[model samples]
Target: MRATALSLASLPARPHKTADLAPGTPAAVVTAPPPRRPRGRPRKTAQERSDGNRRRQLMDGAAQLFRSKGFAATGTRDIAAAAGMHSGSPFYHFASKSALLFAVMNEGMASAVQSQQQALAVLAPQAPARECLRVLIRHHFEVLLGPRSSFIAVMLYEWRSLTPVQRRRIALVKDSYEAAWMPALTALGQQGLLQAEPGVARLFIFGALNWAVQWFAPDKGKSLDELTEQALALFIHAG
Candidate 1:
């Protein structure tokens, strides 16, 4: 009995791995929570995408009608028919014919500004100012008279058709579009190629260029290149 008790006492008790843990304390298991969706208004891109497609169709249809038929003569039904929509469909995108007109003008000016900036971007930084001016004039001609040029054409003839509030909105975009010409005109003036004050020169230059929409006949012998050359000769010193 004594030998048995001594042998049992010699065996060490198993080590207590949880000795430091307080009684009844459960181990915590951590797991990441699921991602939360943004509250208040679900994703709008999907909605805008659908609206955008229809809006673009409406604008394109309106542009064609406003170009061929005068803005005054064109109606919402005509615009909707051109776009392959019901007569009442235009009201979904635009409130009225005048609103549609404003959108076309604004879009036209915005497009013009973007194209001009892009054209200038590709030119070499060291390109001569006269050469830059020539390129800019040519780009302007292309935008004003190129295929799908009806948008600006409508803007050119329908200025008085907009309400004063609408006119102000369109003017804001127009000013930005015209401002792109300033740097090029300034460069031309510094190079002694320009004849009039830069500001006056800009007005005269645009006046002559815009008038081309009415008279210049591409079907005949007139090319955009010819117009650009003539404009340079008239505005810049030949030396």
Candidate 2:
């Protein structure tokens, strides 16, 4: 018994595995919980959230007012009231009415670019160039004449109201939106589906489509789908 005891006592102590320990055991020296990494976007503070929401509200209200009443005639107080904010609140979000106008246009163009990307992404990998153009044309119609289109309509009318710097800034985004069409147009030109040069055809196509904003009333005449087909027919040669 003495020999056995000595032999057992001399054996090295077995390290305790984490799985073997009760969660709260005092002997669990290595049981410090892992530091939790933050998940997803960092939480916005209450004030930050309120500020963002107010800014969006101001833009939306400003867009509606600018579209209905030309930018030159829409006053800051009108925008504030339309946004359900104090008369002086607009200055907190924008330096002046003109700045707000630029914001509206900039945001509108950015949204249009995102919508165009999403529309193009759903196209079949091997879609014909003419079909690609059809998708782009339909999506453009939605951006200009469909529901919640006041933002872009305001942009169409208020371009001259923006400062030179603001106009240049907006033009950058405008070019980005237009650039998406080049590949399809180029392909169509190579296929002899476009009568004019690709660059010239792009300009003519946009001019025609943007003009619809002036006379298109959803209540009267052809639906947007029918309009899209008509536009496609007018722009593309018969196959």
Candidate 3:
């Protein structure tokens, strides 16, 4: 039997004023929220399950090989072998190696955007623009330097390997991630914290953060906190 899920959070309520309560009235019962419904959709059909698993394996395996081995050197068979599928199996999911590369790049951008938005959501609603920028920078570092970073890393280094159509498709999502940062940077410009044009400033910020993939190493050098501090110091002027 499926156990009903209950919310661990309590409904917020203020203390009831005695003046507001009737003399003979019983205290109100705090009912448990009608047992919370399960969070996600119904279970996937077996074929859907199989397709989802295969697609995930292919993407994961492709990201690993593409980041470590140049796109040109990694073939469909290599991705398949890494994914534990038969040599021809990847073709079941992707038309060609180029198509697989595009999927990896697309997924990387989508994931990065999702993560950045979530990080911003947790900040206080009225967070200062500089504080928001700091969170943005820190989030970029996490995406670029954290575990499973190969997808974005692949997107960074193998961009030229994509065909024109593939490039166009990836850029659509990439632009949104950039869009998310622009408003905060524009606010900084208004506050005189930024010296360069806001658009150019955005480019410079991304350039600096993305370059960490090339040189920043957790074992050998600065941690994300140090990088975040140094980056803010470089980009934002102290008043």
Candidate 4:
């Protein structure tokens, strides 16, 4: 239970970018950049290439199974079978179910972050900030409440299963990303565009967005677009 508690206590990982340090920069001198990983393992044998492909296939299958069923209820053989591997095959790729869970959740979270960034980019040039926020809100729901909802589910629920170190690592990334929204949101309220309390707007906005996973049903008489419109209207009214 300690493992689960740790997972619940924090988040997962993220991508990295190289700092701009030319050969002679002070930082570069102190620490020569790590050796570049060769692009592909020096021309692997045909069997090695096939094995690498199979490992990827297994991980993908495992992710899908965990999403459809809660992580705890999902067995390693279930993932192996889903990947068309022998019953014991998942063990070759994942040391334990929690490891597999971490891999799946990490991937899904990264994808979610990417999608949100892309959605916000659409509104960057032409739309007003309020309108842009509305679009961002709607698209965020599309990912969370619609077909791509599984990642958010894992993030909100299954995180408690991670190692403490892993949990802290993920939490830092998740909170940092969440913190990025504040500047824009604060600007809106400061400019008198949104009638929201600056200090509390993030909480309310996220609460509204996250709730979509429960009540949001596709083809449930109301379309997602309509739902977005209504939600935006409600927020605007309060603002």
Candidate 5:
């Protein structure tokens, strides 16, 4: 099972109460969320921007390698070479392979979280509880069905590798993301509108959205709109 921010969140979850999307927004275009640039590093200049882009490419290539194969199976040389750099490129941007793995996962999750927040923002005011959920589901699937799906699955299975300190820090950002949907779910449940237990509702909805990483292909009639409609229909009628 995937680890959702919902299962063990410490903060209160709140669903959006209103939304203002143009009725049909593509998941890929949910607003260009700012990428999760690594901190502890100074901002880049024009020259440095080129270097940063190169470094990002290396990290992205490494992530692809790690996701397609297991971490233990991929070596630094493979990643560096794939990124069009020598065998030491990953070390230039990350401390070690573990750091690179975490960074990739962190960036992917951050992008997803940001997209969710953007989608939620449009719905946070007057959208019905159930309607808000359908929107959330759509954005979630859109974000995952892209190339980052592999990283997502890797993160799900490799979280145990994170250090204790790293774990908590990641948790903080993740909690905020999950909390976006909690308010509406809780409110609906209280009103006898939720389909099942709170945990189940949260898990099932998240699971359906998350599962897109497995077999969702744009060519199989599984476009973002189709998934969005299906998810909305499933959850809305479940009660």
Candidate 6:
């Protein structure tokens, strides 16, 4: 009897059907509904898609204003107005003016990294180290003085305005961007084309290239190709 009772208790519970009920008999068994599966994340709406674009607009406008007027001199209202946003709108995207400044620098460094990668990607797989260095110099000029110049320009000058924590964060990205040039510099040093040590040469080369932002004028001075050639001449010895 105990074994029979255990077997009966162990049996699966069968769902009750109304048709299985005897006439005038109330159904004695009820089953709870199955638990629902958790839902996946919802798709972004059109407005949500535009939020990224708005953030980019704010960064671009802030970069231009910051480069032109200096970070301290520029106000959030000025950035919003330049971006065609309402005066108070920048706060919606950034917690404070310093936060916006850090965003501008962080995003600017990211863009620089991407541009450098693209510039290097186009080289032939077997391209010489000199060619790689040349591409890097030309792209550096474009980054500093070309159509996308404002972002890096802001990064160069407004660096002092960022807190130490922000500086360290931006430095990581900046280091990665600079790392791309090392293999080429090392190769050139191996070939005796580089006059200085590869590491020292890298520092000197960037110092020279970055200084162009102060005096380079597209209309009045050498074109980017001419500048690249001159930089190569200055840094690399003829083989």
Q: Per-candidate RMSD vs. true structure?
A: 24.1, 19.9, 16.9, 12.6, 15.3, 20.9
**How do the residues 1-239 of candidate 1 rate in per-residue lDDT, one tens digit apiece?**
85674455445343222211122233232111233554656544434334235667778888988888888899889988887789797776665676677768777877887788898888999988788888889998998999868889888889888776666666776787788788878887887788689999999999999999898777787799998999889988875
What is the per-residue lDDT of model 5 for residues 1-239, given as tens digits with 9 covering 90 to 100?
A: 22353333323233221111212311121222255566656544433334346656765786678767777888999988887778765575666676666666666677778778788888758878887877777777766776566656666656676666555555666677777888778877877777677767887888777776666667887688887888777776556
Candidate 4's C-alpha lDDT?
0.63
Candidate 6 regions off by >4 Å?
A: 1-51
TM-score each candidate.
Answer: 0.74, 0.77, 0.77, 0.69, 0.73, 0.76
Question: Candidate 3 on 46-128: residue-level lDDT in tens?
Answer: 43334245667788889989999989998888898888788897776666677677778877888888889999999999999
lDDT of each: 0.75, 0.79, 0.78, 0.63, 0.66, 0.78
Which segments of candidate 4 are over 4 A away from where they belong? Answer: 1-60, 193-196
User: What tens digits encode model 4's per-residue C-alpha lDDT throughout 110-207?
Assistant: 66667778877766576665776677777777777776577566776667666665565457557755765776677677777668786587788788
Q: Model 5: runs farther than 4 Å from truth?
A: 1-50, 147-151
Which candidate would rank higher by lDDT, 2 or 4? 2
Q: Please tell me which predicted candidate would have the highest lDDT against the true structure.
A: 2
* Residue-level error in angstroms, candidate 5, position 50: 4.2
Candidate 3 lDDT score relative to the true structure:
0.78
What would the TM-score be for candidate 6 when compared with the true structure?
A: 0.76
Instruction: Note the residue pairs that clash in candidate 6.
Output: none
Cand. 6 Cα-lDDT: 0.78
lDDT of 6 by residue, 1-239 (tens): 85674455445343221221222223333222233433755334433224345666777888899999999999889999987879897776766787777777776778788889998999999999999999999998988999878889989899888776667667878899999999999999999999799889889889999999889998887999999999999889988
Q: Write the per-residue lDDT of candidate 2 for residues 1-239, one digit (tens) a residue.
A: 85674455445354222221222223212211233444656545443234246667788888998999889898899998987878897777676677677778877888898889999999999999988999999999999998769989988888888777667677878898999999999999999989899999999999999999999999899888999999999989998
Give the Å shift of residue 2 in candidate 3: 17
